[model samples]
Target: MDMTTQHITLGAINMEAENPVELAAFWGTVTSAVPSVGGGTVYLPPAGPGGFAMFFRPMAGPRLERQAAHLDLTVPWGSRQAEVDRLLSLGATYKWDVLDEVPHVQWTTLADPEGNLFCVAEHPPAS
Candidate 1:
C-alpha cells in the first residue's frame, strides 16, 4: 500500500442518550445541524465543511458515570459570555468557568439536558 494513498477522516461522534431524539434536538439546535432518524438512531449531519456528523443512540440505562470525553466549542474573542448565556437559555446548565493567567485563556463548562459536559471558549482568530 502506498503511504500517501491512505487517508483517515473522522465521520461522526457517537453518543448514548436516554432519549436519542431529544438529545439530537438539543445538539441540532446548538450546531445548526438538521436531525434525521434511520436504523433506530438519530443522526445530525455536519453543518459545514470540516465538521463531523453526530449520531445519538438510545441508551440501555441511565448514565453510570462521567463521559470519557467532551467537546470544546470555540467562539470569536469577546463572544464567549454571550454564547454561554445563549446555551443556558437552550437548557444547558452552567458548570464552571476557567481562566488561565499564563495563557490568557477563558472557558466556561456546561452540561446538556442529559448532563453531557461541553465547553465554550473565546480565543483569537487564526492569523
Candidate 2:
C-alpha cells in the first residue's frame, strides 16, 4: 500500500516597509544572503547553505511607529564575537549590547538601515 503523506513547507517571512528593496538589501547584508525581487517585493533566502528565508512586504506609506515584531538571529556557539565584528563591517549599525545571565556571553543588537532588529551570536557551530 502506498501511504506516503504529502507535506507543505514555510517559504519566508514578509516584512512591511516603505522601501522593500532597501530593506531587503539591509537584511541581505545583515544575513549575508542575496535578496530576490518578485511580485514587487524583496525576498531573502535561508542563511548559509540552506536555511529559513524571509520576505519584505511593501507598505502603502511610511511607518507610524516601530514594528511590534522583530527578529533575533542566534549564531553558532563560541562565534558571537567574530560574528559581531563581521556584521559591523558589513554595515550593520550597533543598536545595543547584549549582556546575559547564567554562564553569560556577549551579544550585539543591530538594526538594518530600515530599523529592523536582528541579533547575531554563536550558539551552535556550523556542521
All candidates: TM-score: 0.87, 0.71
True-structure Cα RMSD, model 2: 4.3
Pull out the clashing pairs in model 2.
Answer: 75-121, 75-122, 75-123, 76-122, 76-123, 76-124, 77-122, 77-123, 77-124
Q: What are the clashing pairs of model 1?
A: none
Per-prediction RMSD in angstroms? Answer: 2.1, 4.3
Model 2 residue 92 lDDT score: 74
- Point to the candidate with the largest lDDT: 1
Give the alpha-carbon lDDT of every model: 0.89, 0.75
